[model samples]
Target: MHKIAMAMLGVALLGACQDNNVMPGPQDGRALFMANCAVCHGADATGNGEMARAMAKPPKNLTLIKVRHGDTFPRAKIMSIIDGYARSKTMTGPGMPEFGVLLEGDLVPFDSGDGIQTPTPRKLVALLEYLESIQAER
Candidate 1:
C-alpha cells in the first residue's frame, strides 16, 4: 500500500513538472493576432486599425510585399520592431509597446514551457509566422 501510494505521488509530481510549452497553431495564431495585433495592425493584418486615424501617419499595410523592406520579410527586423527595438521614423511617440513584457502575460500553459522563458523571442517567432502566412505571394 505504501509503495503504491508513493508511486502515485511520484507520477502526479512528474505530470505537474512536465514542460508547458505551447506553440500556437494556425487557429491560435489568428486568435492571438485578433487579441493583440488587431488593435493596431487591423483584423486583416492591413495596418488600418481603428486607431490609425488618430496618428499623423497611418500604419503600414502589412499585406503589401512592395512596402516590406529587404528581399525577405526579415523575421529579425519584425521581431526587433515588435520588441520596441526599432522605432518608426514616420510615427510620433513610441510606435508600439515593448511587447517583450506583454507577451509573458499572454502566454498560455501549453505555449511556453517556462511560462515565458523568452517572451519577446517567442512572440517574435509567432508573429513572424503569422506574417508569413499572410504575406502576398511573389
Candidate 2:
C-alpha cells in the first residue's frame, strides 16, 4: 500500500537524522516542527520551504503571527487553528489538512494567561510555545 511505503520511507529518513535511533520526545516542539512541519513551513518557521512553491497557496510566514494579531499572540486561537477546529469542514484537506490528529494525546492544564486553566494537549502546547517564541517584532 502507498501508506505503508510512505511509512517505511519516513522511518528511513528519521533514522538517517538520529545518532541513537531514538525518536523525538512527543512534547519537544522544535523537534516536532522540524520533523513534521519544516517540509512545508520551513525550518525557521518562514513560509519559504521548497514545497511552498509547488502549492497553489504558499504557507504562512509564521513569525508574523503576533504582528497580524495586534501584538498579542492568541494562544487558544492558535491552538484551534493548528488542531483544525478553526477550519470549516469544507475548508479541510486543500490548503491545510486537519491536524486534529494532534489532539489525540495527553492533556495538561494550560492557562491562556486568562486566569482559567484549560486541559490542553501537551503536544499542542509545545508547538504553540515554539510558535510564540518565534514571533517577529513589528
Candidate 3:
C-alpha cells in the first residue's frame, strides 16, 4: 500500500512538471505584450501609450516595422532588440528594458529555410507572431 501511494504521488508530480512545459501559442502573444509592453508601446502598439507621454522621447511606432524595413519584417532584429542583445542607435536610456528572462521558455525549433534551424523560445515566437499580425498594411 505504501509503495502504491508513493507511486501515485510521483506520477502526480510528474504530470505537474509536464504542464509547465506546455508551449504558449500565438493567441497568448497579445496578452503577454499588453502585460509587458503596452505601457510604452501602447495598447494598439502605435507608440503612443500613456507611458510615452511621460518619456523625453516617444516610443517607436511598432506598426510601421515592415514599412520601415523595405516591406520585410526584421524578425532577427526584433528578437535581438527584445532580448537586449542589440540596441538601436535611436534608443536612449531605459527606453526599452530587456525582456529576456520573461521571454525565455521552451525552445521550439523552426526551419529558417536557409539550411539553418532557429531555436526560439515559444513565448518569443508567439510575441513575434502577434507583432507580425499587427503590422500596418501600407
- Please report the candidate that would top TM-score against the real structure: 3
Tens digits of per-residue lDDT for model 2 on 1-138? Answer: 999999999999997775432222434778767766787789888998767777777889999999998999998788788877786565432476656656766676777778897887777777888888888997
Ten-residue stretch with the least lDDT total in model 1: 105-114
Over 55-87, each residue of candidate 3 has an lDDT whose tens digit, in order, gives 777888888999999988887778677656787
| Tens digits of per-residue lDDT for model 1, 1-138 | 999999999999998885546665445457667777788779998888877777666777777643466546665556556656686666684366555433563443222223444444444456656766787765
TM-score of predicted model 2?
0.71
User: In model 1, which runs have C-alpha deviations exceeding 4 angstroms?
Assistant: 1-26, 65-67, 88-90, 100-102, 105-120
- Measured by TM-score, how close is model 1 to the native structure? 0.61
lDDT of 3 at 136: 91
Go through the candidates in order and give each one's C-alpha lDDT. Answer: 0.62, 0.76, 0.77
Better of 1 and 2 by TM-score: 2
Query: Candidate 2: where is the Cα deviation over 4 Å?
Result: 1-27, 88-93
RMSD of each: 7.9, 9.1, 4.2
Model 1: lDDT equals: 0.62
Order by lDDT, highest first: 3, 2, 1
